[model samples]
Target chain A: MLSDMQNNEFQTYGYTFKEVGLTPGEIARFLKVDPSEKEHPANVFIHEILNKLPDNKEITGGYRILPVDDLNVKEGRLACNNVELNPGRQVSTCLQKSEYIALFVCTAGDIFTGLTRRFNRRGDSLEAYITDAIGSLTVEKAMDGIQSQLEKAMKKRDLQITDRYSPGYCNWPVSEQKELFALLGETPVPVSLTGTCLMIPIKSISGVIGIGKEVRKSKYACAVCGDENCIYIKIIKK
Target chain B: MEDLLNKLHNCVEFGKTDINSPYPPDRKGQKGALEYTQELLEKGASPTNIMELALIPAMNKVGRKFSENKVFVPQMLLSAKAMNVSVHLLKPYFRTGELKRKGVFIIGTVFGDLHDIGKNLVAMMVEGAGWEVVDLGVDVKPEKFTEALRQHPGAVVGLSALLTTTMVNMKPVVDAIKAESPATKIIVGGAPLSSGYAFSIGADGYGKNPQENVLWLNAIGYAK
Candidate 1:
C-alpha cells in the first residue's frame, strides 16, 4: 500500500487486486446467491472471474482530505476549503459532525469493461452480465479497503469516520462530480467525469467520507432513501 | 409435442442453454431450449401455442422468482439467454407474419444517462412476453423517442434511467411524447425510479422490475 502523506493536496492510494480481496461471498451478497453452494453457477462464475483479476501492481485509488471550512446545518449545506456543496438534506445531516471531508475516487479500470464489451459484441450477454457485475463489485471492494485504511489512520488520531456517501445517492446531485474533482485538486483523478456527470470509464466510483470524533455512521441512508438503484442498498439488503 | 414443450419450459426456467452447456449441473448434458424448440416446430406445434404455453410462462416464472428473491440477475439473465435462443428459432415465423405480435414497445435509456443494463434486461423481458421491442439504445434524446413513436404508432414507450440525476430527465422525454401523441402510454422503469416519480412525470405506469413491465403492458390491453 502506498499513500500520500496527508496534506492540502490529494494523495494517491494504490493497491493490488489481492489487497482488495473481493471474495465470492461478498459479491454473492449483492448477487443474491449463496457462495457456499459450491456447484451454483453464479459461485462458479465468481471464482472464474476472481482468478482472472488483474495483478497487484495496479493503481486503484486516490483521495484528498479537505478541511470543512463552514457548515450550514439548517440548509443542509457545507463548504470545504475551496468548494460549496449541497449534497442534499439527508447527506448534509449525516455529514454535519465532520471536521474534515475525505473525497475519494477508485475504479476497477479498463480491463473489466473491455472484456464486457468483447463479450457483448459476441452476443454472449450472460458472460458480459457476470463480468460487469464483477467489475462493480471490484471497485466497491477496493474503495472499502481504502476506507478501512482511512479509518485506521483516523483512529490513530483518536478521530472517527462516517460511512461513505457518493453523488447521485441520498439526494446528492451527481453533477457535483465537477465540484468533487475541484476538491481533489490539480492532479487529475484517473477517472474522468462526463459533461453529464456520468463517469467515462463507467466502472469508476467517486464519493466522500466524514472524518471527525463524533461522526459515527449510524445506519445507511439507503434504509430511508428512495433510490433503489444504489448498490449500498443492495448490500444492506444482503 | 407436450413433452417437448415441458422440456423447453424446464430448459428456460432452469437456465439450460443446450446439450453442451453445463449451467444447472443437474441438467448438464441434456438437450436444452434450442433443441426442444426445433423439435417442437418439427412436430408441427403452433408457434403461438409454444410461446403462450412455454416461453412466456417460463420467463414469467423467472420474473416472479426475481421479484420474490428466489432468483437473481444471473438466473434471470440465464433464462433470458434460453428464451432469446428459442425465440430466435421463431423469428422467421414472426417476420413472415405467421406469428402476430402483441404490440410494439419502444424503449431507451433517457438522455444524459448512459447506463443500459437495466434497460436491456427490461427489453429482453418485454420481448420474451411476445411484444415486438424497438430498443433505441443508450443516451437517447427525447426526439429519438418521438421519432420512434411516429414510426411505430400505437406503440407503448419505456424510458429507463439508473441515476437519480438522470432519472429526472424522464420528465422531459415524457413531456415531449405526450405533446406529440396525447394518447400514447409511456411506462418507466429503473432502480432509481418509483411509481410516484413516474406519476409525477406523466408516465402511464412504473415497473418495479422487468416482469412488472410485462404485466403493465398486458394490463393495458397488449395481451398476447
Candidate 2:
C-alpha cells in the first residue's frame, strides 16, 4: 500500500543512528549480562565498543515487494510472480497468508567489522566478542527501523504483515541466500552474498516479510526450528 | 620444585597470566604463570616436568570446566593466555629437543567463509593443549588444506565454517583431503554444524566444542 511501491517496486532507505537508537539494556541482554553489573568486564568492554560506534555512520537497507501466486508446502516452494524460491517448510507455513513477499537486505556499515578484526588480531578476545555482539545488535536495530517504516505505510491501507524471516535462520538453509540474492535482480541492495552464502558486510542481515490484509505478525517460534546450534536459542532461553 | 610447579598449575588454571594480571581478583598483584614458570626454570626444574606437571593439567582442567559450562569463553581465553605465556618460556627446550609437543594441528576456515573467530578459538585451545598449531587463517581453499597436510604428514586437520552455506563447502574439502591423504584425520566444526553433518561430510571427527576436540586428540594417543 506504500505509494511508491507497486507489484515489484524496489525501495532503498538510509537510517541514522538516532533512528536505530540502540540502548544499553538491549546490548546487555544480547551479551547475557545484567545492566547493573556495569563493572563486569563484558559490560565494561561493551561500553567502550558502543562509544566507538559513531552515530555519523549511517546504516542502509533496501526492499522489494513481489506478489506471491503459489506455495508448495511439501517442498516449501514459494513462487512469487515468476521468481521461484524454496525457502523450506517452516517458512512456507508461516508465510501461508501472504499476498506479497518483501525481500530485504540491511547492513550496519563496515566499521564494526574492522574493529572486531583489529581486536581479534591483537588477541583481545573479550573486546572482539563484545564488538561483534554490538555489530549484530546494530544491524538488527537498523532492520527494525526499516520494518517499522514499512508497517506505518501499510497502516494507511489497513494491510497487515507477517514477521520477517531470513534464509539462514529457522529451517531455511543458508544456501537459499543465493536464490534470494538472485531475486533482488542486482537492484543495488548494498549487501552482497559470497559464493559460500555469507553476506559481505559481516554485520549485515537479509530476509523477507509477508504482506497482506489478512497476514499477521506472530511471536517467533523457536520450537519449530531444527538448528540446535543457533545462538538465538541461548538468547531466547536467557 | 614440585610445590613451585603446583603453584604454576594453579596460576594457569585460575587464569593468572603475570604479576600484573588483575583477573581472578583474589590473586591480584601476586606472581602468575609466567613468573612462576621463569622461577621454576631458574631453579633447574625440567621443562618437560613444567609441561607435564603444570601446563597440560591446567589446560585440561580449564577445558573440562568449559565443557561443563562452569566457565565461559572469556574465562577459557584467559586461561589459554596464561598457558601461552608459560609455554613461551619452554620454546627453547622444544627447539633443543628437551621437550616435545603432543603433535601438529593444521586448522583453517573453509574456502569462501571469511569468519575466523571460531577457528581462532579452536586453534588457541589446541595450542594450549600442547599441540604446535599451524593456523592457515580464513577463506582457505581445498588445495591449501591438502598442501599443508603434505608438509605436516601426520598432522590432524581441523575445518571450520560459521555459516550453513560455507558448511556445505566442507564436504568437498573433506573429500579432497581424503583423496590426497587417505590416512589423515579431518575434524570439522563451526556454529552451524552437528556431528551428523560432520559424519556425512566424511570428517573423522566433529568437535562440538574446543574441549571436545582437545579430548579427542588426547584420547587418540597423538602425544608421542
Candidate 3:
C-alpha cells in the first residue's frame, strides 16, 4: 500500500492518500467531531473535503547520509562530514554510537496549503481545517517513506538504524533546521525556512536518523514530551 | 417579522450564507442569513433588534456548542461568517452610535510565532459574539499590544502561540500590557499552553479554544 503511493506523482511531488493512512477516527479528531457521531455534518463535510483532494498527490521527501567524524557527547555536539551540529541531549543520546546520520526533509507540498487558503477565503473553514489536517498527515507519511527507503539501502550493508529525531523534538533547538537544510545541499522537496525558522508549506519536517549496530529504535517517544494534545500521544493510546 | 428573525437565527446557526450556498445540505436552497438579514432590514427591522434578537443569540449558541466541543473550529467559523454577513449590514448603524458593540477585543500571535490560525479563529469567534475585534496580526510584540490597549481602553486582549518556544514570548507581552493598563483582562491560548502556564505568566484567563475565550470574556463582564 505504501510503495504504491510512492508511484503516484503530481508535478514535483509523489503522493497517495493510501500512504497517508488516514482513518475516520483521525479525521474526526482533527475536525473535533465526537468520535461516536459518525454521521455528523462535520464528518460528511470532511468526506467531501477528502474527495475534493487530489488523489494522486500528497507529499515528497529527500535525504542524504553522511559519515560522522568527531563527536563530543559531553558538550552534546557532533561533526558529520564537516557539518557541525549541536543536537542537544535528546538527539545526542539517540545518535551517540552512530557511524553515519541520515539527514532528510519532507513536505506535503503547496496544493493542500493553497486549498486551505482558498477554503478560508471562501468562508468554508471546515474544508480548510480538514485539508490542513490531511496535509500534516501527508508529511508524516512522507517521512515514513524516507525512513523505509533508508532502511532498505542499509539492509544490503548489514547496518541497523536508530529512530528518527527532528529539530524541535527533545532538546534539539529548531534553529538546527538551517544546518540540516545546508547539509542536504539541494533538497528534493521544496522546503524552506522562514525568518523565525518555521518551515514553509507549514507541513514540512526535517530530521536525522542514526545508522549503526548499537543504535536503538524507539517505537514511541511521546513520553519525552507532556503535550496531551499531541497526535503521537493519541496514536499511542489507540 | 418574528418568523424572519427566527429564520435569520437558524441560518446563522446552521452556517447557511445565502440561497445558493450548499452547506448544511438540508438548507441548501433556502434564503440564508445573508438574504434574511437584508430582507429584515429592508422591511423595517431595526439593526439593534436584529443583532440583539437574532445574530447575538445564534452566535451565543455557536459559542456554547463550541465550548462543549459539540462544534469545532470549522463549524464555529462558518457561523461567524454567517453572522458577519448580517454584521456587515449593521455597520452603518454602528458608525452612528445607534448600535453599540459589546466591547473591543485586541488579539495577536505573540512575537516569534508566525502561526495565526488559532488567533484568527478567536478573532472571528469574538467578532461573532458582537465585539469589535482589532487583530494585530502575527508576530506581535509586547509594545504593539500595549499600544493597542492604550488606543482602545478597557478592551480585552488575547495572545496566541503555536510553538512551545514562542509561547514563552507571551509572558513579556502580558506583563507589558498589565504594566500599561492594570485593568485590562488578558487571555492566552495555543497548542502548547495550559491554564497553569497562562496563570504563571500573569494572564487573567486562559482559553483552551476560541469558544472558551468568548465565555471568559463574557464572565469578566465584557458581555453586551
Over the stretch A1-238, how does candidate 2's per-residue lDDT look in tens digits? 4445565767788876656788777777765556676555666776666666676745888788877778777788898657788888888888877877888899887877888889888878777877777778778878887898888877787888787888877778888887888877766556787777789888898889988888886666675563545655655654
Error of 3 at B173 (Å): 2.7
Docking class of 2: medium
Tens digits of per-residue lDDT, candidate 1, A1-238, equal 1133246666667777787777778877778777776777677777887888778655478678878888777787789875888787788888878988888998777777788877777767767787888788878888888898889988988889998888877778888888887777665446887777898778889888998888888574666774456777776676
How good is the docking of model 1, as DockQ? 0.58
| Worst 10 contiguous positions by lDDT, candidate 2 chain A | A226-235
First chain TM-score for all predictions: 0.90, 0.90, 0.84
Clashing pairs in 1: A16-A56
Error of 2 at A43 (Å): 3.0
Give candidate 2's chain B TM-score.
0.96
Q: How well is candidate 2 docked (DockQ)?
A: 0.51
Candidate 3 TM-score over all chains jointly: 0.75
Task: Give the lDDT of residue A41 in candidate 1.
Answer: 68
On residues B27-56, what C-alpha lDDT tens digit does candidate 2 reach at each position? 878999999999999999999899989998
Collision count for each candidate, in order:
1, 0, 0
* CA error at residue B50 for candidate 1, angstroms: 0.9
